[model samples]
Every structure is written in C-alpha cells, then in structure tokens.
Target chain A: EAGVTQFPSHSVIEKGQTVTLRCDPISGHDNLYWYRRVMGKEIKFLLHFVKESKQDESGMPNNRFLAERTGGTYSTLKVQPAELEDSGVYFCASSREYDLGLSIGAGNTIYFGEGSWLTVV
Target chain B: DQQVKQNSPSLSVQEGRISILNCDYTNSMFDYFLWYKKYPAEGPTFLISISSIKDKNEDGRFTVFLNKSAKHLSLHIVPSQPGDSAVYFCAAGDYTDKLIFGTGTRLQVFP
Candidate 1:
C-alpha cells in the first residue's frame, strides 16, 4: 500500500563525480519508468523497465546515464562523471497494466519522490 | 522536438468559478491523453485521462476534452476551489506506453 519511494531526497556533487538514484516501485507493478526535468525545462522521459528488462531508453540524455532494474522490483539510475547541466529533479513511476486507463497504480499516479534534487556543481 | 505543449504558463480564477487549462501536441502518433496535477515539492498525480476512442471524459468536477484532429486537449474544473490550485500537465502517449509531457500550466484559484 506504500507509494513509490526514492532515496537521497537531495544530492549535491561536484562535476565529474558519480551519483546513483534508487526507486522502489509498488510491489507487483510490471511497468517502471524514469523521468526528469532540468532546471528550466519540461520533464522528459529517461527510460522504462518491465520486469527487470529495459523496455525503452530512447529518452536517455547520454551514455553517461545508465539505468538498471534488478529483478524488476526496484530500479536504479546512475549518472557518472556528472556534468553541470545534469542538475534537476528525477522521478520514477510505475503502472500495473498497459490498459487504456484504470489498472494504473496510485504509484502509477506517478507519485514523485520528494524528488532527488540533483545539483551538479 | 517538443510534441506536447502547454501554451499558457499560468491561469488565475476566483473561487467558485470555472478554470480551464489547455494543451496541444504536434504528434499524430499520440493515442491517449492525460492530465496530471502537481504540487511544488511532490510528483505529478493523475487527475484524469481520455483515449483516442473517446472525445470527452469526466469525473466529478474535472472534465477532460480531447480533439485528436487538432491535436489539442483541455482540463476543465468547474466551481474551482482553492485546493485545486497546482501545476497541471498534459501528456500524450505514443506507440510505446511512455507519457510525453508538456511544460505544464500553473493554476491559482483564489478564495
């Protein structure tokens, strides 16, 4: 009954460092997604995971960003050698089914974490 | 290429009035449209959605209208209340189930 949970509500690191954000989606959710919004831009899709498999990663900003879903229960997004432009809020969402509507979890409500406010200085 | 766009940056309305937020998309592949409401610190929450099969969907005081021909959609809140104030995002779904979102419109319903 818990909503989507993300770790390290806030992160601040010098450029060229590394950071990993974790998301624990609702138990049993088959669909997991990652999205983010840069300082002054609209939120953009990063990728999606379905049962430990990468479904789509077309929106990933660059090779520096990597995502993994071990066992499809939870997910992790890693940014290596982070750059100043990577500063933003990253969110994770999950859905129970691909149905037109309904069947989506409240977690699917896309309940955002307090948001991992990442600031790459 | 921004597929979904929320033209209005912000809208204001008095309590008990009607508030309408608009969104447009340039993509023809979009098959489903949704509206989400978000507070400053939290993540976006699904308010309502309409599929390509339907033109209008309503729940209580919130109604979503979709015009696939024009690639536009709107969220209308009747008798707006102060609690309804928040940033509203319009999203479109493509071939994949991924939700592409607009920049969002901020709504302020004054009491």
Candidate 2:
C-alpha cells in the first residue's frame, strides 16, 4: 500500500499571497492530520479530520489558515495572506481509527507524507 | 511553552559505536512516547514507540528507554552505521490523538 502523498513538494510565494497544499492519505484510512514545523521549532499539530468532519481544530494558528477534507478522502490546507512566519514545512499524516481498548501507540500508528515546503517571501 | 525538548541540537558518532539521543518532556499526562527520523526534504518517519507501562522497548538495533519519573526518554542505536545519520524527533501524546514534538536533534555517524 502507498503511504501518504503530498503535492507541490516545494512552494515559494510572496507575502500576503495564498497557497493551498494538498495531501492524499493511504487507502481506507479515516483519520487525517496536519502539522507544521517552523525553522528552529518543533513540529506543531494544526488540526485533525475524521472523514469529512473536522474532529479537532484547536491547534490552528489563526483565522487566515483553513483546512478541508472533502468526500472524506483527501485534505487541503490553505493559508491566505500568508506571513513570513507561515513559511515552513507542512506535513500531512493519516492513520486508522484506534480501538478504544488498544494502546494508542500501537493502534494509532500514523504515517506521514513527504511534507510540502512553503516559503513566503 | 514547549512541552517536549531535545536539548542537543546535534550529535556525532563513529560507525560501530553506540549513539544515544535524549529527550525531556514537561507534561506528566503524556503516556505514549515516540521517536521519528527524518532525512533532508522528507517528512518524519516513525522509528519506535514506548508506552508508559514499560520502561524500555527494543527492536533490532534501536532501543527506547522511558523514565517516567524524570519525564525523560532516550533512543539508543547500537552499532551505528552511516545510514543512521538523520534528524531525530521525540514526540509525546496523552489520550488525545495529537502529538507534541520536540525540536529535532541531528545525528551524524561517520565511518
């Protein structure tokens, strides 16, 4: 089976421009997640999706960033009016829903895509 | 505040030697810990994971030790090879699905 795949491996845009990064998860995976890593910082969670519904978006940085998973398949993260701070690597991951009784590490092993590198100049 | 931290930004090791990477976390609620490796221009790949229920877990040449009391964890690579060179990240998670990651530590193994 193919691992998670992302599009436009690298993107360069001017400040205030909008950029949309796409991710296609492994087949039959229902849980999708987005994370970002700024230079010299840790990878931070952005949001999660279970099928077509947004499960948790508490990690979203601001209102300018938007994420959507349509038809419960692929996901897209769009940043509008992008700032210098928004230039970073955006990673997309997916996993099968965990069984309530199983250990989190074992049941919810997430697979990541080759992140999309966004540079807002 | 950063919940997870990898103090050493980089490490160098000779091939056939042991390479140890350390991590510290502040959140006591984190029960699941994981280690990931990333090459240049690539996303992190899960290496190994350990649950709070155990103090150590090993696979092949890699071993992960978790010290719950100290809120510390370490990854050990035995007989380290040049291919082991990469950036290693430590991550923690509670009951929630989201993972809190640390700033990565770059490891370089030379022959």
Candidate 3:
C-alpha cells in the first residue's frame, strides 16, 4: 500500500502570491494532518481532518491559510498572500483512528509523505 | 510557548555505539509522546512512542524512555548504524490529536 503522497515536492512563489499543496493519504485512512516547519523551528501542526470534516484547526497560523479535505479522500492546503516567513516545508500525515494512549504498534501508526518545500521570495 | 523542546540541535555517534536523544516537554497534560525520523527530502516518519503510563518501550535497536515526573523522554538507538542518521523530532499530544513537536535534533552516525 502506498504511504501518504504529496505533490509539487518543491514550490517557489513571490510574496502576495497564492500556492496550493495537495496530499493524498493512504488508502482507507480517515485521519489526515497538515504540519509546517519554519526555518529554525519545529514542525507545527496546522490542522487535522477526519474524513471531509475539519476536526481541529487551532494550529493554523493565520487567516491566509486554508485547508480542505473533500470527499474524505485527499487534502489541500492553500496559502494566499504568502510572506517570506511562510517559506518552509509543509508536511502531510495520515493514520487510522487509534485510541489515545494506546499502543502505537502495528496497525496503529501514523505515516508521513515527502514534504512539500515552499519558498516565498 | 513551546511545549516540547530538544535542546541539542545535533548529535554525532560512531557506528556500534549508543545514540541517545533527549526531549523535554512542559505540558503535563500530554499523555502520549512520539519520536519521528526524517531523512533528507522526506517527511518525518514514525519511529517509536510511549504512553504517559509507561516508563519505557523498546523496539529492535530503538528504545523510548519516558519520565513522567520530569516530563522528559529520550530515544536510544543501540549499535547505531550509518542508516540511523537523520533528524529526530519529539512530539507530544493528548487525545485531541493536536501534536506539539520539538525542533529536531540531527543525528550523524559515523562509520
């Protein structure tokens, strides 16, 4: 089975421009997550999706960012009016719904895709 | 406020030695902790994890130890190999599924 997959592995955009990054999670996986790592910063969660519904988006940096998961299949994160500070690697991850504090052993682990490196110049 | 922190930005170890990476978290509510390994041009991959209830968990050459009292966790790789070199991230979260990640520590395993 294919792990989570992301497109446009690398993107370059000017400030104030818009860029959309897409992620295709593993087949039958209901959980999808978006994360970003700024320069010299840790990877921060942006949002999460359970199927097509937005579960939690508290980590979204600002109003300029939007994430959507349509039909509970794939997801897209869009950043508009991108700024220099927005340049970083955007990662997408997926997993089955596992119980909290339970074993992350076989059949209950999260997988990540090759992140999309975005550069805002 | 950064909930999780990996103080060391990098670590180097020779093959056949032990590589230990430490992480500290400030949030006592975080009930789950995870470690991720990222290779160049790849997203961070699931490594090992331990629950707040457990003090230690091991898999193959990797072992994760959690100290609830100190809110600290460490990942140890025994007999480190060149393939073990990568950026390791520590993440903590609760049932909410919102994970707070620490700045990664790059591990260089020399042959």
Residue runs of model 3 more than 4 Å from their true location after superposition:
A103-107
Docking class of 3: medium
lDDT of 3 by residue, A20-93 (tens): 99999999989999998888578889898999999899999999999999899999999998999999999999
**Taking the tens digit of each residue's C-alpha lDDT, what string does model 1 give over A22-58?**
9988777788889998985798889988789998999
Q: Find the 10 residues in a row with the least total lDDT in model 3 chain B.
A: B91-100
* Per-residue lDDT of candidate 2, residues A71-112 (tens digit): 999999999989999999999999887421145545457788
lDDT of each: 0.85, 0.91, 0.90
Clash pairs of candidate 2?
none
Output the worst ten-in-a-row residue range by lDDT, candidate 1 chain B: B91-100
Q: Per-residue lDDT of B1-111 in model 1, one digit per residue for the tens?
A: 889999999999999999999999998877778788989978888788777778888889999898888888899999899999999999888557888899999999998
Name the top DockQ candidate.
Answer: 3
How much is A42 displaced in model 3, in angstroms? 0.6
- DockQ per candidate, 2 decimals: 0.49, 0.57, 0.71
Note the residue pairs that clash in candidate 1. Answer: none
Candidate 3 residue A31 C-alpha distance from true site, Å: 1.0
